[model samples]
Target: MKTAKIHLILSCLFIFSILSCNQKKEQKIETTSISQPEMVLDLLDLQANNKLGKDTLVTIVNDPVYHKAKKYKAVSASLLVKTEIELNKIDSKNTKIVFECVDGYKPEMPLELFLNANPFLAFEDVDAPKGSKWEPILKEGNEMNAEPFYIVYPSISEKDSRYKWPYNLVKIYLEPLNKSTLELYPLKNKKLETGYTLFKNQCLTCHSINGIGGTMGPELNYPKSVTEYWKENELVNYIVNPASFRNKVKMPTLGITKQQSQEIVDYLKYMSENKKKI
Candidate 1:
């Protein structure tokens, strides 16, 4: 009888040990995922597999790209995101939603803000002519269309500066909100805050300071900064109106004042001195 009890106790203890270790292992994995959560979604891939969720119709009173009222066949962007991943596993406040366009123009907004709004991924123009999915958009002497995908919001104001309407969008990324700020910030000079803010708002989407921005535009500070070659006054003027300096210039008129342009140039000059090889 004593021998049988000893064997039973040993087996019970072994089983309990295994269960405890497994529980600890699961807790460790959960903690790791929450600590450094990042997700990249190839929108095209998702669409190809018919995983984009239900389609619906959405209207934009004044589309920023087309400059007119527009209607499109779209899917609820927030719902797609919510279904793809566990939102509760990550901290929305510390994260951002980046829309990656085909032209390499990457624009991002706070993840919490994006989720709160009624955003949509438009896949087709409801008013487009027969045999076509999109209408031509003429801007900066270039003719293009918002093919594949475009991010839009139905209730958001067209003039709301806080929202971003990115056409030709191809991918979506959820990343740490402060990833760029940690690298591109001008920590040495407090007076350069104005320029930094302007860059973050207007330029960072296209241009990078030290290989840390969108690839749509040239890197501003790695091999050579624009300020190093162009005259300060001329650089400012060029930024305010790129079309004035060159024929069929790809860079659009940012509509910022000459002073704002100068502020951006000043920030660029500062970054030129603080170049990181990568």
Candidate 2:
């Protein structure tokens, strides 16, 4: 009788332990499933809006798509806002937003955005010169004017003023008139032709996109390969300050303003998306 009772007690304890362990494991998994996507999206949103936040740190684990992309010079990732809350928040902030990307596994320094409370409603970094500011401006009746903000990196020297890097930063400004403006001055073929004309006159000797142009540096047409993994803001940040990522990259800072860079980005996006033989 005593032996039978002892065995029964041992069996009950073992069953209870197993059930408790299983329950804890299940809870952990559920928590991770809910939290991981939100964290990733938040990081992307912060980068897209050029908003400075410390929550952007992400630990890279292996994913099949990321690994496969590593084989090629460029890789693309899908950006899905997993929850309604996340989607609503992003939508409320800016209607025109760029998705996040990264440049493979090369860890770049975190970009900073500081909000100034004084005469300028702008954001600046500590490294920029004193008194230089970036302001978010808009005409009174425009809704988008309240959405996107610009950053101005102060110039250290007179020559640097001509280069875009010192004042270059990713901007997510809303332009409600952009579409109508494009329609009024249709540049579907014209912009590329004109942009290319401008490129040849100004940039052909040193930089190349397709088969033509200079060979001093890597081609910008397939930036996804070179910066395939870079987040959208990181790419802009890199353009703003190349030395921030690479010490020996030879591309000179062209003093390209936020608007000019966007045009260049649009041109690049066009070429990459429509690689039709022309």
TM-score of each: 0.89, 0.28
Error of 2 at 39 (Å): 59
Compare the candidates by lDDT and give the number of the best one.
1
State the lDDT of candidate 1 residue by residue for 122-214, as single tens digits.
999998879999998887667789999999999998888878889999989888899898888889987888999899989889988878888
Q: How well does candidate 1 score on lDDT at residue 259? A: 93
Q: Which candidate leads in TM-score?
A: 1
Cα error of candidate 1 at position 257, Å = 2.3
Clashes of each: 0, 16
Q: How well does model 2 score by local distance difference test? A: 0.36
Mind sharing the TM-score for model 1? Answer: 0.89
For all candidates in order, the CA lDDT equals 0.89, 0.36
Report the number of backbone clashes for model 1: 0
